[model samples]
Target: MTFKSINPANGEVIASFEEDADYALKIRLGEKSFDRWKNTGIEERIKLILNLAVILEARKAELAKEISLEMGKTLKSATAEIEKCAITAKYYCQIAEEQLGSIEVSNYAHKAYYKYEPQGGILAVMPWNFPYWQALRFAIPTILAGNVVLLKHAPNVFMSATTLEKLFIEAGFENGIFQNLLVGIDKIESIVADRFIKGVTLTGSNLAGSSLASLAGKYLKKSVLELGGSDPFVVLADANIESAATFAVKSRFQNAGQTCIAAKRWIVVDEVYEEFLNKVSEKINKLKAGDPFNTESDFGPVARLDLAEKIEGQINFLVKKGAKKLINGVRKGCLLTPTLLNMSRDLSHSFTEELFGPVACIITAKNTDEAIEIANETNFGLGASLWSQNLEEGEHLLQKLNAGSVYLNSMVKSDASMPFGGINQSGYGRELGVYGFYEFCNVKSYIIEK
Candidate 1:
């Protein structure tokens, strides 16, 4: 069987790649490559990553275009995603040596320290949205810390996957150091169970994360999962209403709203509910959803026909359950119109499921306490944003949110300098930052007595 890349903007097959028939050989190659890569100094890895960043910057336009063609994200957003990846690479390069250095436990009569060491090959199961950013976000730090990556990218974005693999090679990565395995789901278990594959890291749905985590556990391998999120953008009564409305539009609709950390739920207090809703709806109307290649377009397609269909179905279900459609949504092919739904607090129980599209749900709260209560109603606790002019109160309210990351007057986003992950059904384990570098490493304790 072959993995086909279908352009979501139009029903066109851009390319197809045959599944890796010799995965065992590839695993062996990863094993061999890891042996050498793990032995290489951090300084050497840093140099290569610096080169990789340079390549990413130089080919930003071309790479962004490929991303747009494969996944249907607007050219501008795709370019920004590529830019973020390159910045992340450079960030890791700057911090890797210090972060991976041995931590001095004690140094009296006996010297003692705990060091971060590489653990063979890591299998990365990445999703299609923000394809390059998601893969490199995990791979950069993990690889810099001395692990090889066997990436199993989403099938629809295989061109981006292969392009990344080629870019790794061009940046002087060994044949097996950063290999993209064009394999199906059936092939994952064996790869995870292999001796060379030390651990697994996945950025996808809760179901996928559960299955992969189960496999990793069955094989006694470590697993890190960054899964689905129904992140809340809480607009308190005291917030800068104008700014909150503007950012709410941006956070919900960016990447056509397929983001894991996007503000999926807008929990607005009663005081500013109508005002915030009106402003956001106006912004939504002004958005230009068109061809991914179009410079003038704000966003594009949903990445697949099924994804668009799924999103529409979810909207319909909510509407039937008495959710008021403040702004109607339209679906044509893979392009979905941005939607806004005013959800009754009684139906708060239904907020658990994620509608991965350019759709936003506003859940009204009587007050701040009710707002926090409504925010915590979901099974997903990925990330959230609390908008309030009172900095202290916002910080205090943030603590009540059940999410991995919480921001005050800002949209939830991933920064290379900060650790990013989620809690509850959003999945376990952390990615990005120094903590992420240690996720797939062996934190070995060393002691020497004279």
Candidate 2:
């Protein structure tokens, strides 16, 4: 069977490609490349990684267009995503030497140090959201650390998967240093268990994370899982309501509300609830849902038709549980207008479950205590956004909020300069930054004799 990539905007077929059935061959290739690459000088790797940034910029338009068509991301957002990926790749190159270098430690015998050694080939099972960014950020760091990469990108973005492979090749990397295999999900378990694959990192749903985590555990291989996030955007009464509402609208609706760390729930203090709601609702109404490639489009289609169905289904569940829609939802195929909802908090799936599309829910809290409570209520402990003019209050609340990363008076976004990941069901392990650059490396200690 052919793997088809359909454009969500107009329901057109972007392209169709054959899935790579030669998993063993690719695994062998990755293993061989890792053996040779692990001994390759860090300076060379850094140079190649920096070259990727140059190439990404040169082909920004093409890459962004592919992402926009494959995943229904607005052209503007898609371009921004590519730029962010390029920046991340280069940043990782800048810090790889220091981050992956050996560190000295005191030992009684003589001298001791921590050695960061590459184990072998690493597998990256990435999601379609942020198609290029998510995959590149993972692969670049792993490969730079001297381990080869086997990317098992989401099948929906097969074209993107191949493009990324070509990207690394064009950057003067040797064959198999970074390879993208167009394979089905069913093959991932054995690939993770393969003796050649040293570790696995996945960025996808909780269900997928669980399956891959189990396989990695069963085989005693290291695994990093970055799963779903139903993050809360907390707005306090003392906050700048106008700025809070504006950011809320941006955080929730950007990318058609498909981001893992996007503010899914808006928790507001009662004193400013009405004002915040009115402010955000008006902006939500102004969102333009149209062709993704169009410059004027603000909201594009959710990746696929089924995703839109899931969004609609969740909204229906919430409305049945006494929740009310603040704005009438306009949905056509994969295109959905920004939806503002007043959550009833009735034990409904919509209240607790994650809505992965252009849907935003509002929950009012009487005070800061209630706001904190509502923020921590979700099963997902990913990134969160806190809106408050009082820096001291937001700083103190940081320790109280149950999330991996919390932004103060700003939107939560992944940066190569900082560690990005989540806690609880949002999954374990971190990615990006110095902390993540060494996730798949062997942090070993050895003492020298005098």
RMSD of 1: 1.0
Give all candidates' CA lDDT scores: 0.92, 0.87
For candidate 1, lDDT tens digit of each residue in 1-450? 978999899889999999999978988999999889998998899999999999999999999999999999999999999999999999988888899998998567388899999989999999999899999999999999899999999999999999999999999988999999999999999999998888999999988999999999999999999999999899999999999999999999998998999998899998998899889988999998999888888899999999999999999999998998889989999999899998887776655678899999888899999999988988998999999999998899899999999999999999999989999999888998788799999999888898
TM-score of 2: 0.98
Residue 375 of model 2, lDDT score: 87
lDDT of 2 by residue, 282-346 (tens): 88888898898888999689999998999999888887877788887878999998888887544
Taking all chains together, the TM-score of candidate 1 against the true structure is 0.99
lDDT, candidate 2, residue 64?
Answer: 91
